[model samples]
Structures are given as structure tokens and as C-alpha cells.
Target: MNYIKHLNSVFELFTRDSRLNPTHISLYMALFQFWNINRFPEVFYINREEVMVMAKIGSKATYHRCLHRLHDWKYIRYLPSHNPYKGSQIQMLKFGTSSGSNTGPSSEQVEEQALVPYININKQNKNFNKHKLPKNENEVLDFFKKEKWPANEAKKFFNHYTSIGWKVGGKITILDWHSTAKNWMLKGEEIQKEKTLYGPSQKRDNLKIIKEKDYGQPL
Candidate 1:
């Protein structure tokens, strides 16, 4: 198989595949590397832990899900090994142009070959609009320091957003994360000022009085 041609063809397919997410692509590329190492074997055995590390997938559940999805979509043929000592089997489907073949398949041929649905241009555009999250906590910390915000606040911001899948309000996608971090900083400052003005004990007492007030009496 022509490595470059295969990659080009597969990537073109990936661009049109809306069902695939980043994790699926990452896992597939990792498997491709292993295939290359094995000299483009028709079939290969893969250890789960090694594949997971290569794909940067932390959870085993995620790894299996993407692998099974790829299998279901006909990108590869997967055969699970029930034995603990043996690795699983995989056979990558050939998508590259062969010596006797045309440069690219026709539209109908491509559809019939992979059973992929019609390309969704709007979904691809929406995926493009998503903001990229920090690779790790250190990146978040570095950005916070560059913005002259407290170093400790970076951890708080990173933790909150990461826990919520880096979304705004846990529902809306974050388009620009730097703006969100700055807003957190401003909110932190306002909270600090409130604490200074009211004192912790007085603030608690004020909240208690408000909660205990009788609404039945005339205003």
C-alpha cells in the first residue's frame, strides 16, 4: 500500500465523516502507526494498553467504544480475543489507489464502499467554531500568569471548565476561552472586595437576617 496515498484518502473520508470525533481519529492514527511498524500487515495483533497510550486515551471504555465504532463503520475489521494473554486482531481496509486502479473512486463507489452517509457541511462548520481547550493544567496556568491574574486562580478556572467539558454555563460551547478566564478573574476580584467590605461574620449574619425576615407583615 502507498502510505501517503492511503493517508490522503483516509483523511478525505474522515473530513466527511460526521460520526467520528477527535478520539476516534486519534485511535485510528495510532493503529495506523502500529500497522506501519508491522510492515503493512494484512492483519495485526494489538495490546490494549499500548494502543491506549499511543492514542492518548485515558479511559478503557472510550478506547473500546471508538474501536467498535470504527469496526461498525467498516474502516477496519476487529476480532476480539477472549484469552487474557492474547492481543486483539485488526485488519485495515484498503482505501488508497492501487497500481491498476483509478486515482479516486466515483461518488457512488465511495458511498457504496464505506456505507458512509452524505457529507454534512453545516456540522463540519459548527465543529470548526469550537474553541480548543488547553492541553494540560500548565497551559492554563501560563495563560493566567501572562494575563496578570493570580497563579492559584488558574487551577480553579481550569478545574471548573475541565469538569464541565470546557463549556460556558455547562450548556453553551466556549468560542473564546481567554475571555472566559478574564471574566473569572474579574468576578474573583468583586468577591474579594465584598469579603473585605462586609467581613465574613457580618456577611453570614446579613444573609441569615434576610432569610429569617417575615414576608407576611406589610411593607
Candidate 2:
């Protein structure tokens, strides 16, 4: 299978309706990438340390918290296991569905899991509005940074680029954006808007203009 095509398909699965938060979608996408390498459809293992490393997260504690959240949200199922070769047996993951109806330990059980609906990546890509910006790497980085984007939001920024048809050597670029990076900045702006309109959640406060930097000269 074409690797880029597969990756695009996986990404499409997550961003379909925006039902899943970006972080969750990213985590699932990572898992899908991992699955492509292992080819272990029935059983796959991921440990806390490994997850942190893959996610580029700083703290193991934070990784554990995220893991728990994923589990609680039914994004993946964790089966206890003990392996002499490995640290922990967090066996198997079921992606694309929350309902226990479609996947589980057995193939038959998996067949019962509900299949989540996702948009066609090809369709979205065709429909996405291409927002051209500066081609200078520094200018691009600075523009987003000036927007008060978190250091970890590189992925979403990269996604924006792909959505706009930017490519390098005919390959899609991967960004370093962490899960909450873009959402945090967007949420902050939303909060500011809400405060301006509703006179704050707690008290009436002066509103500050958050100037967004313009895209530098296009290439």
C-alpha cells in the first residue's frame, strides 16, 4: 500500500466530523502508524514509556494521565499482561470505534464492534481552501509563534500546510505540534471573545486586542 495514502486515510478517520479532539485524533493516528509497522491486527503492545517517547511528551506522569483519559473515553482497551521481555503488557488497541460492539479479543468479537464513520481524506483534501502564506521557514514559524502558539503545536500547523497543498519532494510533512497546542491557543481566543461579549465569567474586565500577525511575503 502507498504509505502516504495510508497515512492520509488514517488522518481522515480522525478528523472526519471533529467529534474527537485533536489530541485524541493525533494519538489514534500515531497508533495507526505503529500498527502499520507491526502488522499485528489482533494484538499489539504499547507501554507508558514507549507512549511518552512516541508522543514526545516530557513526563511519564503526564503520559499516564493521558493514557487514562484515552481509556476512560473508550478510545483503546488495555488488557493486563506480563512479559519477561517487556516492562508491561498493555496489549492490543481498537481504533475507529468506541462501542464494544465491533472489536475485542477474538475476530468474532471484533466483528461486533461498531465501525465509526469517517470522511474521505481525498474529498477533504480536494475541498480544503488553500491558504497561501510565506515560504520562508523562519517567517512561517515566526508568524505562528507570534500567534502565541504553544511549542507543541507544530503538528496542527503542519496539517494546515498540507490542507493548503504544500509539499516537499512529493511528500506530506509532519509537524511537531503536541496534542493541545493549537486547541489551547484557539480556546484562549475563544475565552477572550466570550469575556468581551458577556462581561467575563467572573467579573467585567477590560478587553485587550490580540493582534494576529499576517503571513509574510509569499514565495
Q: lDDT tens string, model 2, 67-167?
A: 55555544565554465433332333433343424232222212122223343445334322332334544554665587666534544555655565543
lDDT of 2 at 15: 43
Q: How accurate is candidate 2 locally (lDDT)?
A: 0.42
lDDT of each: 0.67, 0.42
In model 1, which residue pairs have backbone atoms overlapping below 3 Å? none
lDDT tens string, model 1, 3-113? 766787888878877667778888899888766644555676666655665666666667787899888777788889897634577887777756635332233323322
TM agreement with the true structure for every prediction: 0.46, 0.33
lDDT of 1: 0.67
